[model samples]
Target: MSPPARARPLSKAAFSPTFSKLKTSIYTDSLRPSAPVSSAHFIRTLSWNAPGTLIATGAADRTLRIWNPEKTNVKNSTELRGHTGGVERVAFHPVNETELASCSSDGMVRFWDVRSKAVVGEVKVGGEPFTLAWTPDGSEIVAGRKDNNLIPISRSTLTTITEHHQPVQTNQCVFTWDGSAIFLTNGDGCVKILRYPSFEHFYTLNAHTSSCYALSISPSGGYLAIGGGDALVSLWDTQEWMCVRTLDKIEGPVKSVDFSFDGSYVVGGSDEDNKLHIAHTETGEYVYTIDTIHPAAYVAWHPCRYVLAYSAEAQGLKIRSTMDVQAPLNPSTLFSVRGLLVVITGGGTSIGLAIASALHQNGASKIYLLGRRIATLEKAVETLKSSSSAPHYVDVLINNAGVIGPRNGIELHESESISQLRGAMLKDWSGWESTMAINTQSVFGVSAAFLPLLEAENIRRHWQGSKVTGYGNARHHSASALEKIGTDADDSRLAHIITVASIASYIRRCAAGLVDNASKGAAAHIGNMLSTLLAEWGIRSNVGRPWNENNIGGLILFLVGNGGTYISGTVQVSDGGRLGVFPSMY
Candidate 1:
């Protein structure tokens, strides 16, 4: 073939030529000492969730693994085991991160809730499903079997909608951007276009000289890519249905193909060792080559970023990023709470209002104040809104509403006569009851009420619903998606609760008062309880002992901001070492 077209400079910065093998617990054989290790279980297919926070991989080991690329710990992955045969393909729902689907060589396709690690649905298609794809709308999934059968399965009801047997051996299938049609690769080196729902053939393209094995549609829906056994990948204009470009540097049959998010480049996986090639779409020139120890069998680009994910034979999943990608941990960017929706209780005055001020100054999107007095809350909201440049804002409750009761236990004990002590104890029993109702009971009541809204916030941001507590549920937000609401993605921080309990919670001196200390202690424990109870639901809870107003405000900013997404279920004592100075058990 003639020399490929000249590559543009933009392609050089789009991705790095060198690919790095991501070390996961499954891939790091050293992490699992008890289990027998083997290099024979190669990855078969992989898919990235809609938010780009997770990657789901299917492998020859008959298991499906979900990975949060941001975490490298031994527990960062959750394995779903049910497939009796080797898994062939895995796909995440187009909009739901928690919902996933996988097909295996045992002639079954199973739907799963990754959080619960339970099979939600399944179907026996009568043939080994070698490929899977979810419609753009996420209402249905299509599974292509090695026996040339194409089956459509409904998301609401896991049963097969209908089965269509293709004339040629089906290798892979993908739905168009509009879900109006499907592009299916087959043994005839041709791409068959079929109208959806009805499964009627629309047209056919003579894409390669040999069996076609791969298919990918550009994000813009303007171009179609086809890979074949002839070791060539062809790009076609979807509108005109004409060949636009041909890429042929592959050393073996192309097994998989994908277009980057912006449609700037296309990558092809080959059966030849280390032959993963990335080419500029406009110029059709090879821009990068990924060297792998084994043949690259599957390739996928993140839906919203430049990061590329691929599976090498027996190597699990690998991820590589471009130099243009910025680190999420940059100090200057980490603490800002921009675009966050917040609600704060007792926010009309004191530390609650101080935190509102911090959030207002820092660019929180929306803020709502909750307090016993509507006038106080309205006044605070008016003042903060007047100061903020952004009109919309929401916030987490500070849970600072409280009341101090009677005298210290020691002082009450000073009464020499039993009658005097009894009088002192009964003097303000009502006040003690009020303190518990406000400080302790309200903390739990308010946080519990907000759980639904918090979970809804995650869904509104295009993330999956909060996971129900169970075996495999864990935090799923990707580092890149956790930054803020931007052109690319929304802030990935989960809903958080920060209760302002006093330092008296842990102080055994009883200097704060009998009911006051007791109520604060209950509030602190409530926060701790919520940390575990709400953790599975993707909500974080923390108790803050606010000794200083400014310290409490800064602490609230950190807890609700992107920097604090990883912190949950702990007591943050901002007492300036007061606990150390006091003769108390802290």
Candidate 2:
């Protein structure tokens, strides 16, 4: 629970002195001042192009300045004006650097063409604007108002199309990868998502114990990083709409966080200590710290470069590179394959639903979910589709139907009458038969019905990778195998078959003199047999061995992602490794 070492504050004199000396020694002969300008009124936000060649800053001076940071005598090349009040935040169009959006205290958000320094359009909300976000397509802009409402503005018409209501003051807001939704953090320690265009409440995430301030989505938008008054940064899985991990005991309230373009490193800024801290996104391990006395307003990781940009009071804008440092590689960058179809059965249980979510956040193109209950399946599907990126990918199917049944038997006990036993038998028979029918048989029916759609995806991957070795053939093999099964193939195209088997499958209970009853052990035998059988077709099957409700989802996630890619043909047993040492005699 110790605070990250990178959260320490830096002295202004010390940082600038070293930076100045380094600058003087490296380019002393070429260094020159570009006609000393007036003191900056109030610096708000800073941004850089993907290449780190150009820099942009929004200031209270009512001017947006674009600069060439590479030159020693860097000078402002263009000054943008349109905002009537102090520009509080600025974000560059991800794909087009020539365009950018600025939010001001005037309750107006203006989109500008940086190259022309012309105001393309403006969106007026009701209150002071605190934050602005652009969709992945750059087609829409989301503005966060002081009253905690989020307004989605169309980039074309510059008019508000949707507004999200927050019960508390909204500190920040941003869109998911595909830009179909907006994630907003309130000062009341809550984060919620709203579907774009429709403005429907998607999911409400409660993680922090204090006010939530800043929020940043990983490059893939699979994980969300939140900083708040609690002085901690928590990572949440977008799929399950729940908190996965929390990095605690920081020096101060985090004001901002930026994930590396590759999704490996996370850099955060603290308001209390006025310092910048870096950590590994996956493990939450502290990396390093940059000392700065003045509170940092914003931080950004260059999309394709090693440089990181931040605004410091003493230093107008500072750039640092991890190129020379041996930093841990980013896990988010490892698997960049987009548009893969993943199907999940048993989506009603916490674990099954969690796996589907983790896959979606990690960049899976489509998710096919199966379960028996219509209500649960509908809720899960709605949660996934609410994300902006969800529409681009398809939800092939979510079967929320299941049944369980007895192989054969009718027994009477001394404590119950024949009629009572009959009633119990009827209920158990109905439940068991229904469970197996939906959990096992229905899965086959749905997969069979969706085989053609899955095969079509395979062909697309084949065509996309025709020039690459092994890719086209791999896709073809997958497609042909999936098609041949025609939904009846119980053991094919099972990229990840997550079974929520009960611990009772392994534990032996001798209560009521029912000693050594081997029938209850059938589930374990069936799971093992199915796993071994499925391995032949490249499908991996693993069971979620959760000992408690809390760990159910995590165990399922471990088996589905890269961590479980090599783990096939075996029951995962998610009892946190305790099951390994426990003695099981049956």
- Summed backbone clashes in each candidate are 13, 26
Residue-by-residue lDDT tens digits, candidate 2, 1-586: 1111121111222223322322210111112334433445445677665345567787776767776655523343666877788878888775566677888888888888878889888777868887888776677777888876878888878789977776788888788765578788887788878887676788888868898889888754567999988888899877787787877746788778787654556777765666777666656666556665666656777664345677665345666643322333335433332345666667645766765676666666666566657888888888777232332222233332332344223343432587875653454444554445544555456545554444344233221112111110111121112223232111112244445555445655322222112323444455556556544333445555566645654554455443343565566565554445555532
TM-score of 1: 0.57
Against the true structure, what is every candidate's RMSD?
10.7, 21.4
Residue-by-residue lDDT tens digits, candidate 1, 154-215: 88877889889888898888988667998889898999999998989999999999999999
Where model 1 places Cα greater than 4 Å from the true spot, the runs are: 1-268, 272-295, 299-329, 374-395, 408-410, 413-424, 466-491, 580-586
Give the Å error, residue 540, model 1.
Answer: 2.3
Worst 10 residues of 2 by lDDT: 1-10
